[model samples]
Structures are given as C-alpha cells and as structure tokens.
Target chain A: MTSLSTDAIPHAQSYRGLVARRLAILVGLAAVLVLSVAVDVSLGPARYALGDVLRTIVAPGAADLQMRVVIWDIRMPMALLAVTVGASLSLAGAQMQTILANPLASPFTLGLSAAASFGAALAMVLGVAIFPAAVGLMVPINAFAMAMAASLLIFGLSTLRGVTVETIVLLGIALVFSFNAALALLQYFASDQALSAVVFWTMGSLTKATWGKVAITAAILALCTPLFARRAWALTAIRLGEARAAAMGVPVRRLRLEALVLVSVLAAVPVSFVGTIGFIGIVGPHVARLLLGEDQRFFLPGAMLSGAVILSATSVLSKALLPGAVLPIGIITALVGVPFFAALILTKGRKAW
Target chain B: MVSLALEQVGARYGRREILSDATCAPVAGGGLTALVGANAAGKSTLFRRIAGQLRGPGIVRLEGAAPHDLRYMPQDTGMSAALTVYESVILALKQGGGGWRLSAAELAAVDDVLHRFGLADLAQRQLPELSGGQRQSVSIAQTLVSQPKVVLMDEPTSALDLFRQYEILEALRRYAEETGAVVILALHDLNQVMRACATTLALAEGRIIAAGPTLEVLTPEMISRLYGIDSRVERCSRGCPMMIVDGPSGQARAG
Candidate 1:
C-alpha cells in the first residue's frame, strides 16, 4: 500500500508539470511576439534604433517630429495590424479544426478566402461595390460582405441537414471549388489594368496597413476573444468527438453554429484588410498543438500568440528581403510556412494530430 | 436507494420505429443489471434514449438524483488521440465538477482511478498509442472518475480479453456496491451477463421479453425465444448458472 501510494504521487506531479510547461510556452510565445513587433517597427527605409522606437512608443508626443511620425504614423500601425490579423486568423483556425474534427480544416478551407477574393475581384474588375464608399474602403467592405454570405450559406445548409461535421466539411469544400472557379472566370475577362489590380488584391500585402484598418481588426478580435474563451472547455471536449461532447452536455449543434459565426468574422475581417494571407491559419494551430497538445485553455491562446509571432516575423523579413520595396507578405508567409509545415509533417505529422 | 424507471419508452430512426413501447422494471441501486439482446434488437437505441442522446417518447426518471448525475459510456471508446490519459481523466472530472480548476480532492480521485485501472504507467502516454483494450480500460476509468450517481455502459467489455473482461466487470460490480449507483450494462454474452449481473432485462425486437433476476429470467425457453436458439441454463460446479447453446431452433434453421 505504501508503494502504491508512492506510485500515484508522480502522476499528480507530472500533471502539474504539464500545466507549468504549457504556461511557460505561452509566455515564451508572447515574448517572441513582442520581440518580433519590436524588430518590425525598427527595420524600414529609414532605420530607427530599438531604444528610440521603444521611447517613442512609450511617450508618443515627446519624440522628435520625424521620429514620432515614423513610429506612430507609419510603423506602429503596420506592426499592430500584423499582430491582430495573425492572432485572429490563428484562433479562428484552431476553432475550425476542433469543431470540424479535421486537423486540415482552417479559416480558409471552408471557402472564406475564396469568397473574399471573389468579392474583391468583382469590385476591381466590374467596378461594382456593395456600398458606395471611397475606393480605398469599398473593396474590403465588399469582400467582408461576400465572405459572410458564404458563411451563412454553409450554416443554413448544415442546419437543414442536421449539422454534422461531415456535412459541413463536404459543403464547405464544394463552396471552395465553386468560388475558385468563379474567381478564375472573373480574372479571364478583365482588362489589363483591372486584371493587375485584381491580381495584386489577391497577393495579400501589408502595404495597405493603416491605423483605421488596425483598429477595426483589433476591435473584432477584442469582441471575439471573450466569446471564444468562454467556450474553451466545450471546444476541448469537442476534440474527443462530437457525440462525446454532446454526451457531456455541450449542446453540439449550437456550439458549432457559434463557432462558425466567429470564424467567419475572424477570417473575413483580416482578408478584407490584408488580402489572402494563407497558411498561417492552418499552420499556426498545428504549431500550437505540437507545443501544448489539445487543451483549449492553452491551445487557443497558444495558437493566437504563435500566429502573431509568425506574421510579425514575416512582416519584418518581407521588408528586409527587398532593398527599397517590400515583398508581398503572403509570399513570404508561404515560403516560410511551407518548409516548416513540410518539416513538421516529416517529423511529427504521423502522430501529432 | 436510487433507482431508474422507464415507462413506455419508444424510439425511431426516420420513419422506422426501432423501440416501441418498451418498458422495464425499476433498476434499483447497488445492483448490476445486464441488458441483453441479439443484433438489431434496439439494445443500443434503448441505451441512447437513456443516455439522452436520442429524443424518444419516454419518461426516464431517477428516484434520488438529478438528470446530470447520470453518465453514459458508449461502446466506440471515443478517446481523443491527442490527449494523454491524465488529461482525458482531468477533462472528465472538469465536466462533472462544472469548474475550470480541479480541487485537491478531485485531482486525488483522478489519480486513484488511474491507479485502480492499472493505467498509472500510461498516464502520460497519448491515448492513440495504447492498444484497443488499454483504451477501453481508460474509457472505463474516465466514466468512473466522474463519480456519477448512475453508470450506463454499452458493450464495455467487447474489446477485452477473458481475464481483463472479468476484472473490469468485477471492478464495476464492486464500485456499484460501494457507491449504491445503479449500474446497467448492455451485453451480448449470456455467461457474462449471468455471472456479473444480479438483474437482467432481455430485449427482443424493441420489446421486453423478460425482466427479473438473471437466473430466473434467463432460462432455456427465454433464451430460445430471444435468440432463436436451443440453449440450457444449468448450474456449474461453482454453483453459478451457466448458459449452454445446444444448437439453432428448428424454426430458425428452416427459416
């Protein structure tokens, strides 16, 4: 009996250790995000010292006119926008993967990106905006509207069919292919200038980052974070299986609908601002799972921080890659993400999910 | 003692009725009851209705506990491959406790369950890394760790070897006796049902064929009527009733 009691001690201690380790990883990811933001703000055409950037940020009006404008007007919004979009897309991806019960599922996998692109293409090619807004804002509004439309379509269909994961996935895939084909048709008939504009919109750059865009994305994130956090336990239970989650009193259909609406908002807002920044939504959650397993309490925040870190790092690298011009943020993400994703599959892919 | 009473329970899938007006004796606490039936006999459908997974016409009432206190374990053993055994048990406890953090007592209960199920060594192992039998054991441990007032298991011993099956059934019987929880198992094996259960509810084509003590209701004629087989219920040298299937019934063979 004494030996048996001794055997049980390590199990409890190990669980505590697991919790500590997850916390440490979350803290470490937050630090990486902060560091990446610092690097992103410092590196540009006119370089600013890290100390100066920190000082300027701390006391915005105290810095010299040039320094303040560079830090506050130009670089700060871009860095903040990267963090917001990254975290939003990643959290959405994490919830999507769980609710769908598919590791490959992401914010874009359900045709949100395709729908957003189609809407943007319509604005650029046919000069048709959903609302009569300024040219700078009209495309994004249309794109966001179209993405939500796709979400509503999918949600309505799944509801009619009883809201199973299989139904959602199959219907989402059908939408993806249909939207992609429509996008192709639009690009085929466009004039040279319109076609170029459409192509650029799909390339997904951070060059369009502004304080207004940053605020919008940040506001959306703020509103959605608490909602997601409240459902974190139910999301964790969902990782077991939908039936099991329902058995545990999770109200599975309602949970899926709530998650779907949130994911649509998360994916749409970012795609509207930054274009189609792919791979982070899918890869960020996988990286978090590799680090912290499937406990949603940690997994959700871990995915958000991992995404913020990756996108901020990529934003810095995109500027550095070209001497005077910024490389497209989407290209850098894929270049970096694909290799890392491939390596993850080779090493831990078989058992990680 | 707590008890579960079902009255005129009926279930259907689409337009086809699976269970029609099925009723059973009030299963009292501190006793292990076996629900035995052949294939497509609505055994699982009935269990689902009791588990609240299916919306059927019935009044499933508990004598002394709330509806939330009843726990059901499905036969599929839907364990998450990503969660370790310890984490899975913790998730179960959190679900039962309805809290974010586990108290010291709750954590100790999880550890005790893991140790009792011989899963202490594999507590840190991912669930998918274990064999089917090991996963089943972990599933059972997860159910028990919740400390439910009533426990329902569907084919809980289907994946176990003979010794492990006996061990698991014995452990469940002991737990029911100690906690006075109404324990019900949907089983197919006659000998296992007779040995492990004090009461038996035999189902046939969605109707109750017999409901009484295991030894009394599980006679040769009842077995034949339920399963279309020629069988005998006799006492073994250890004085436990055993089932011996002689052959198929004449009508069954002709059909």
Candidate 2:
C-alpha cells in the first residue's frame, strides 16, 4: 500500500502554486480587459477625458449631464456590447474547438456568422423575415433564426453515424461559400438603398449597439459560463481524444451535443445583435489556449477575457484610427487578428495547437 | 474478488466484424493479464468491446466491480494537448463528478500515480513536448490516477524502451496487486508477458484461442498459430523464461 509521504507536501504545494499562477494570469487578463473597456469608452467623436468618464461612470448624478449622457447612454452600451459579444463569441469558439476537436472550428469559420449575414441580407434586400412573428425586429430575429438553423445543421450532421471532424469543417466551409453566394444574388436584385444597407451591415459596426442588446448578450454569456464550468474536467479530458474521454466515464456524444447546442445559442445571439464581428470567434480561444492551455476552468474564462480585450481594443482602434469617423470594426478586427494569429503560429509553431 | 469474464463478446466496424465470439475464463483481479495477438488479430477490438465503445454481441460480466469502475487506455500515443503531465493526470483523476476545486486527496492521488510511474520528474512538461516513451508513461499515469477497479490498456508498452517497459509493467503489476484491479494489457513482447503477467489470454483472428496461466497458454504450437512464427520458450542465464524466435512458420510463406 502506498502511504502519504512527507514529499507529498512539496508536490501538492507545487501544484497549488501552478493553479495560483494560472489564476493570476486570468486576473491579469481581466485587468487588461477592464483597461481596454475603459479606453474604448473614453474614445469617440466627443473625446471625453478618461478621468471624467471614470468619474461619470462611478457617480453618474454628480458628473456633467452631457458627459453622463454620452458615456453611460451611448458609449457605455457600445463598449459593454463589445465585451459581451466578444466573450460570447470567444467562449463559443473555445467550446467549439473543444467538442469538434478542431482548432480551426469557430462560430465564424463554421459558417454561423455567414449564415447570420445571409439572413440579415435577406431581411435588408428582400424584406423577408425568417420568423414571421418577429417581423418588426426582422433583421436580428432572422439572423438569429438562420444562425440557429445553420448551427443545428452542423450539430445534426456531427451526430450522424460516421461523420468525422474534417467532414464537419469542410461542410462548414461549403456553407460559408454557399451562403455568401446566395447573399450576393440577393444583393444583385436589391434597390440601391437596400443594397447599401446590406453592404454596411456586412461591414460590421458597434455604432448601433444598444443597452438592450448588451443585456441580452451578457445574459446569454452568463447562462452558458456555468454550464461549461460544471463540465470543465470532461471538456479538458476530451482534448486528450474522444475515445480516452469516453473511457473516462464522460458521455462524449451527449457532452458534445450539449456543448454544440450552447455554442449555437452563444454564437447566434451575438452575431444577431452585432452583425458579423467574426475574428474574435477564431482568435480569442487560440490566445487563451496559448496562454492558459485547455483546462476548461481557466481556458473558458481566459478565452472570454482575451476575447473581450481584443474586441474592446479593436473598438477603440475603430474610433481612434480616424479623427471623427468610426471605421468598420470588422475590418480592424481582421487586420489585427490575422497578424496576431500569424505571429502566434510562427512563434509557437505547431506546439500551441 | 474483482473478476472479468467475456462471453461471446464481439465487436465490428460497420460490416467488418473485428472480434467474434471471444469467450474467456473469468480472469481474477490482483495481478497482470497479458493480451497477446498479432497486428490484425483483434486485440484492440476485444478491448473496445469490453470497454463498451463498440457493440455487437457480448456479455462482459464483472464481479465486485461496476461498469463505472472500468477504465480503458487505448493504444494511441499521439496526445497533442497543451496540458502538462501533472494537469493531464489531474484531468483524468477529476473526471465524472469533481467540482471546480481540487481536494487534497485528489492531489495526493495524482502525485502518487506520477511518482509510481516514474513521471514525477516530468510532471511539469507539456504533453506535446514528450517523446513516444515518455508519452506512453504519461498515458499510463493518466489511466491509473483515477484508481479504477478494472483497467484495459491496449499496447500499453509498445512505445517504451526496454527498461522503461519492464519498470512500467512491474509497477502495473504492483498496482493491480495492491488495488485488486482486473488489469489487462495488450502487449507484443511475449517475453515481457511471461516475465510479468500471471495470466495470459491468446487472441488470434478475433477468436480467444486460449486463456490460462502464462506458461500453460504460451507454447511452441500456440506461438506458431498466433503469429505464424516458429518460436521456442526457453530460460535465460538468470533462470527467467524467455521466448526465442527462430523463423516464420511453415504455414506462412513470403511472396
């Protein structure tokens, strides 16, 4: 029989130390995210001082009325929207990478955002509503509906008898191309007004972010975080491989389905609200993976924080890159995400994935 | 009192039946059982059948152990996860129902298994950085950290060096003896099987040809039938039993 030894103290301490170190890294990411959000809020056409914005946020009634209105009513929603949407998309991508066992798998790459864009373009160009009851809120509702449909399609295909991960990824790419082609066809038949609206919507902007949208996205992120946290060990075990995870008493198929369903909602809600901010879904989880590894406990939160930081920083860049005009956030994200992703791949090489 | 008995346990991938009617005696716990077979002889298929990953026709009966108490480590060494050795072992240990936090007992269990498997020094090394032999040892640690009552490991020592393989097999034997686990490991090295395993199960072409004590189940005729190779069972200068391979059996001819 193996008994507890004096050396056990050191090993346990070392492990505890490692855990503390990871948690500290998470705290650092959260700090960076907070600073990014603050900087994101401080920038805009009005150009409020950072100190005034913080004071207005801390004590709304005592601050200047104009600054209060600008910071809390307008800028705060946009900034928080970036945070929630970023966290949602990143968590969705992280879990997608986990369940599908493909590092390239993400809400954007798997055609959910493309499907949402198609849905939104249909509403803008053809005045078509996927869900008739929500006709007044046609664009976002239709986007949510079509995104769910696409996610469910992928989920259903994944549950088939013999479909592999590569097959799912290939199917997603096919969906992306098919939806983009269909969207182009719709744009071709549209009025100039409708066409311009469709084009701008595809560009992806945080300028139209509202408090209601922020609340809905934040609520969804809150709902999904605990569910992913509860299965943290199982999700981490899955990275070892499906067979090993199943052998460890993890219901692999069920877990994957559940996670896919959650990922579907997570990706669907944010893309519906924010149009098509696509890069966070692909890059956020990878950043978290590079830093925190895939221990879902840390990786989950790390992904959310990293995504929030990246997107909030992107939002700030969108406003800061030009003097008064807000550049399309999508262009900035892609421009930034590609170089950062490439740098990570080049530096870490094949080890990080 | 833990025991594992397979009655007509069969598995298939689509239409190709890999294992068929593989019945064996109730192998008792507290010792090593070697599963010896050729490359295409359905050793992994049998383990998958028993592990319940594949289903066709089978009755995998266990005594004094629940299905939940079983753990199967497949013969895969391509673990490319970014988790370190300690984290990977802890991941296995906390599967099924652990909460967010790790308890002291859990940490002790992981530490004990790592040290037992000679993986303590490499505890902080990431999985992708390890060599094939080191990866196999890490796999062994991951498999046993949970302290399952029944264990199935396919080709567990295939990638290990000679000394590491021997040491791991000995550690597994001791682990089985201490915990009374029904441990079955698929191994290609028959000499290692003879040295460590108390019971031997011979599989050939999806059939369980024999199951008995290592010496009784492994013979010149049985070796020939299993691998299409002519071999001799002899003793080394240290009086340890060893398999001496001569050549391919007369039944097999290379084209």
Q: What is the interface RMSD of each candidate, in Å?
A: 4.2, 4.2
Residue pairs that clash (backbone atoms under 3 angstroms), model 2: none
Per-candidate total of colliding backbone pairs: 0, 0
Off by over 4 Å in 2: A1-7, A348-350, B252-255
Candidate 1 — which residues are off by over 4 angstroms? A1-8, A133-136, A350-352, B235-237, B253-255
Which numbered prediction scores highest in lDDT against the true structure? 2
**What TM-score against the true fold does each predicted structure earn?**
0.96, 0.95
Model 1 C-alpha lDDT per residue in residues B1-255, reported as the tens digit of each score = 889988989899988899988887688989799998888898888878888888889788788878888888878875654778898888877775455565666678889888877788899998768888998998888788877888888889999999999988988998899889999999999999999999999888787778989988888888877888899888889998899899988654211
Candidate 2: tens digits of C-alpha lDDT, residues A1-353: 12355255567777777888999999999999898999988998997778888999999999988889999999999999999999999999999999888888898778898999999998998899887887889999988998999989998999998887778889999999989998889998999999999888888888888899999998999899999999899999889888788777788888988998999999999888878888888899999888888888899999999999889999999998898989989889999779988998779754845
TM-score of chain A of 2: 0.95
